[model samples]
Target: MNFDLFWLFRSLPAVILGLTIHELAHAYTAFKLGDMTAKNEGRLTLNPLKHIDPLGFILIVIAGFGWAKPVSFNPEHLKNKHRDEILISLAGPISNFALAFFLLLCARGLFVLPYFHYTATGIEIINLLVSWAVINFGLFFFNLIPIPPLDGSHIYTTFLQKTNPRLFQLVYTYGTWGLLLIILIQVNTKIQILPIMPLIKAITNYCITLLHFT
Candidate 1:
């Protein structure tokens, strides 16, 4: 497949911003939950480099779904360890969804403004906003798959711990391979196993439809 450098360039800013905010949300949530591990490790910042995993970021650029450096937190420091861990793990995706909504609103508002004609600048701004919204939404949903190393796995494991320790152990031990297998299928096939892009489009289209601007 041929790579589109211009498309990559246009999407880079949004990807970086989405990843940064996603990770910062994790770090901040962990800190607020009394686990200062991420904060102490200097992860409580908006710096893109601090959050960007090289391989993951490259995958995002090429494949549309990727991850970032996970924020580490000590469970001992949390009051309700399992529940709190779930909440902390959820913060990243929640932040991305929030950003997606905000960017959607911006795109809609820009389209509705009387002074905002479809000039080069206006078109660029709209494209940027839409790109950012799509990226954020992609991140939000992509991270919600219940697989190891992703935020959703923490929640799944937490709940499983109370219900079935054996099953939890089984999943915990083998989950990484499941995630790797999904990536492998995505990379090797055209079937598009993950529906992240369709979900992003649906949400974005809904937001734009709500605005009734186009």
Candidate 2:
């Protein structure tokens, strides 16, 4: 919430890493599924410059909902068109979850290391890593709300297609509203009612529990 230089400075690395991984997951998933759209556009690598969306990045830091420039994917190239497309789309959020968990475990290790003789730098790195975990996990969970333009929507879409095609279309078409509602609930209200906040709290608590009370 703090927009001071210190917060912005520390948050920059986390934003870059978060956004980079978010896009890379999609590109890599598509590439693995036989689509070269993302790779051809040079989005498969970890170089943050390639995926940065200037406006999105700025809004993301401010409003906490910015996305990276989307990686191109032609679902037609996938062997199982519908299934693989859903997988490719779902990959981004899944990767964020994985990264957040990895960072959490890493932070726990750093947190305990100081008691065993780690230096100040080690603790500082741990702080940064914890920030990364919190940010990544929040983003991951929030983005998977089954709204249009979000990975969860694609995942949910695949399932809906099998049940009721018309309903699926309606949901997908109205996804913008769903997304907007998520933003409003989580951002505007002083009392947080969104699912994401609780999940983040549980994850953070788990990290602390893992390290033990020293």
Candidate 3:
């Protein structure tokens, strides 16, 4: 597998910022929902070092989809276990989406600046802003796949645990392995077990279009 050095250079900032914010959102939401585990573990910070998983970071930069170190929380401490779990799980993706929208607006704002296009620095900044927005959008959708260790799994598995205990046990036990297998297959071959690029591109384009009218 060949790595693109230029792509990595441009994507590093977005990857770090997006992953940090995503995990921090999880930690903060869990803390707010009465789980102090993440806070006690010193995860309620904006530091990228605390949130980034090395392999995930590399994969995201190269493959456009990956994850951060998951924020741990004690379910026993949560006020409403099931409902709060869903909210905590959702916080990461929601925060990424919000950040993406904000970044898009910032990028749009750059277009109106006088002399912005004439300067190399301004052009690079705008490009970075757009890249950041799209990367965040990718993070937003990627984390929502209902596989284990991802945010979406928690939401669905919470309900599954109640309605189908046996099935839930199977999923909870094997989902991570299944997710890893799918990733490995994609890495080795051309099959897209979880095709998400189209969704990411569609949403990013839609947001850009909306910004154009504003």
Candidate 4:
């Protein structure tokens, strides 16, 4: 199995930043909603080490997508358990979208610098900015996949729990395993059951167009 270590190296900053902010958003949102579990557990900090999972980080380096340690929160402390949980889960992905937009805006501003194209450092900065923006965009979309343990699952459950109990239970029961199986299949077969890559590509392309990045 050959992997491009240099590509991974370049992507490291984006991965760390994206994952760190994602978890922090969850922790912060939970705290805002009266759940101090994540805050008390020392997960409210912006430190990447506190949020990153070793296996997840390694997978990101080798594969282009992975998750971070989920911020733990107690629903009992929340004002409205179901609604708050959905809010907390939604925070992570929304934070990624915000980060992506900010990064792309910065990249756009940087690209307009008079000597940006001529200087090696400026070019590198632009590349990193674009890379970071795209990575965050991908993360934002990936987390929205409605599978168990993913933020989307909470969203689906929140809206459907009252309307469709049986379906929610079925997905909750087998979602994680199904997600893993799909990941494995995608890695080995290069066929996507979920089309995550295409979605990511579309997002990146949109960002590029929006930023007018040459």
Candidate 5:
């Protein structure tokens, strides 16, 4: 593990922002759908400390995988249960993609200057925006995996009505077992079945292209 202080310091801000906003979107959308649990807990804000999942954040820096403290929601509070659940569950990953798109636009539009002055620091700005874009892209793709306790699992439950819910129920019940199994498999397999690295690279390349990189 290359534990360089400088790299960690630079990566810190974007990781914090990425995790915070992704969770905030979950809270906000759920609240709008009539769940006030997250709001009552004061999780609707952008404070990274509130959303930081310590182990998850650490893994994010070390292995590029991270998650935040999940925002609570009372599904019973929603008027339209099915539609509302789908929307709320979809909000988290969707928000990360939105963030990626916004970062890509800013990187391409405002930072790259073939016009009005400031050519010297363009590389710095490009790096920052590219970093921001990659972080969000990773979050977006990773969270969309349909595994137990992930946002994508919630999404799948909402959408895939025909699947054996009991199977996922078992996964949720034995969540610690499931997590341990996942980690062990990841270590031994040496090939991630659902690796998001390719998707992350694709998003980065798209960003570079948007910024007119040849």
Candidate 6:
């Protein structure tokens, strides 16, 4: 077993930050959309402790993919169930993307400071920022996978419920198991079935280009 302690040290905070922001966005959006369940449950805050799931956090640290505690919302309280549900589901991923971009911008800003690049601390800060940005980007895309219990599933199922009720019911019922199976297979076989890294790298490269970072 080849354990990388340095990777763990760098990724732990990034994972916590990403998960915290992602779940908080969900809770906040639900609150804004007239659902008080998340807020009433004391989840509408930036505190990572409220959002972190122990096993999930551990998995993300070791496996590069995992989940946070989900925000609960009452769809009945929403003004428009379908639209508001989609919006609430979208909030998590959107927040992660926004955070990633902000992190990249922060990194870009750090590059121009006088003699900042000459110090070990500056380089470490920039590396941490970039790592955090990448983790947030991963969270953004990973949550958007259209499987049960993921954010994208709400959007997918909402539309599918109209066109094909039976199919939608089937997916809604068993999609989580399917997702788990896929994950298990990938873990054991080391196959890149999801192909999400390419997208993350593309986005990172695009941000780097736009920010003129070396």
**Residues 100-184, candidate 6, lDDT per residue (tens digit)?**
9999999889988888967999988987899889989988998899898799899878778878999988997799878877776
How big is the positional error of residue 134 in model 2, measured in Å on the Cα after superposition? Answer: 0.8
lDDT of 1 by residue, 20-134 (tens): 9999999999999898899998999998888999998887777665778888898889999888999999999999999998997888879777767468888788878988888
lDDT of each: 0.85, 0.79, 0.86, 0.86, 0.76, 0.87
For candidate 1, what is the total of clashing residue pairs? 0
Q: What's the CA error at residue 108 for candidate 5, in Å?
A: 1.4
Model 5: per-residue Cα lDDT over 91-154, one tens digit each: 9889988888888887777654575226656777767777878878888887777775777777
**Superposed Cα deviation of residue 107, candidate 4 (Å):** 0.9
Task: Pick the lDDT winner.
Answer: 6
Question: What are the per-model numbers of colliding residue pairs?
Answer: 0, 0, 0, 0, 0, 0
Q: Which segments of model 6 are wrong by more than 4 Å?
A: 159-169
Candidate with the larger TM-score of 3 and 6? 6
Candidate 3 lDDT over residue span 12-107, tens digit each:
888888889989999999998998999998899998889988888777767655678989988889889899999999999999999999998898
Worst 10 residues of 4 by lDDT: 183-192
* Weakest lDDT window of 10 consecutive positions for candidate 6: 57-66
Provide the TM-score for each candidate, comma-separated. Answer: 0.90, 0.83, 0.90, 0.90, 0.82, 0.91
In angstroms, the error of model 3 at 82 is 0.6
Best-matching candidate per TM-score: 6
lDDT tens digits, residues 35-89, model 4?
A: 8889898998988999999998887777665789989998889899888999999
Native RMSD of candidate 3 (Å): 2.1
For model 2, the stretches where C-alpha displacement exceeds 4 angstroms are 1-5, 114-122, 158-170, 191-193, 211-214
**Per-residue lDDT for 176 in model 1?**
75
The TM-score between candidate 3 and the true structure equals 0.90
